[model samples]
Target: MYAILGEDKSDVATLKVILKRLIGDDSIKIKTKGYNGCAELLRKGAKQITAFSKLGLAIFVVCYDSDGKDPAKRYSDVVSKIIKPTGLKNTICVVIPVQELEAWILADIQSVTNVFSSWKPKEINNPESIDNPKEYLEKLSRDCNRRPRYNHATHNEKIAPYLDLDKLKCKCPSFLPLVTLAENHDAHVAK
Candidate 1:
């Protein structure tokens, strides 16, 4: 079981599902509440770790967009806040994608092309370099088939599925941590 803490629900809807697959649990892994925002997530985390951690929970995965901040710095800052309250080191993994979650979406050229015909994925070799990924996504979404009114409520989920995990993991340095977390989670479950 696990808890998904993120800056917002839109940021992690697909991620939680992908992570479950990534974790490689042999049997169905029951998770605590599906997902919660970081502020609320932090409070929930503080509660579960202190009061209910023994309830088959193995890890707390925190996902946050860098939003112009340094990914490493953002990751460390978040870790400092949660570690003392949760007393979890290995069990708490922070996923900070540079620029924003959209950066990861753009990392996979195939996925980007699947959604938008106008985007040149090969040109986006470094997603982190883009100043405003969300804007680019919106523009590209308009260029998608029939300009299908792209918004977080409608299209965010569509992006992750098309995203090639191998490509995303290899191209985005920030995304590698997510893969590492999955590997570690699998090891812990194996034990």
Candidate 2:
């Protein structure tokens, strides 16, 4: 079992779908448990969530956007307040790229083209550094052969299944933790 506590529905949904694919188990329990935002999770809900400690092979993953703030500080916040308080082992915190979580989707350009067909993406060597990723994604998504609504609820879940995690990890530095978590998840499953 893996639990994703994050900002919104679309963002969490994207992570859930990607993790499900990464584990190659459609039946894997990747619990979203409603769309809990980071503020709420850092507050009351963090203590209330017990699955991390109780469930075997569990990983409690938190996803939050950098918001142009210092990721180290944000990471420390989660560590001190959430992870430390719960004393949960195998917790992974990933600071999403500039501005918002949508930038993660753009990390894998090939995947976006695969879903949208002939969707041309500009060369982005460092997707994490891209300013205003949501706006960029929205513009690129509009140009797709088949225009799909670009958002957490609409496009994120749709694109995640087709996402090439390897390619994504290569392009976005922040995505490395996700790869690490997937490896850890696989190791736990094998055990």
Scored by TM-score, the top model is 2
Per-prediction TM-score, please?
A: 0.78, 0.82
Per-residue CA lDDT of candidate 1, range 1-191, in tens?
A: 66656766667676765676566553645343423455665455456554445665666677767789777777766766655767755477678878877777777745655655554445467777887787887766576544555566456666666677776777788877778878876466675
- The candidate maximizing lDDT is 2
**TM-score: model 1 vs. ground truth:** 0.78
**How does model 2 fare in lDDT?**
0.69
User: Tens-digit lDDT track for model 2 on 48-95?
Assistant: 456545655366677776777887888888777767777655555554
lDDT of 1: 0.66
lDDT against the true structure, each candidate: 0.66, 0.69
**Deviation (Å) of 30 in candidate 2:** 1.0
Off by over 4 Å in 1: 23-45, 48-54, 112-123, 143-145
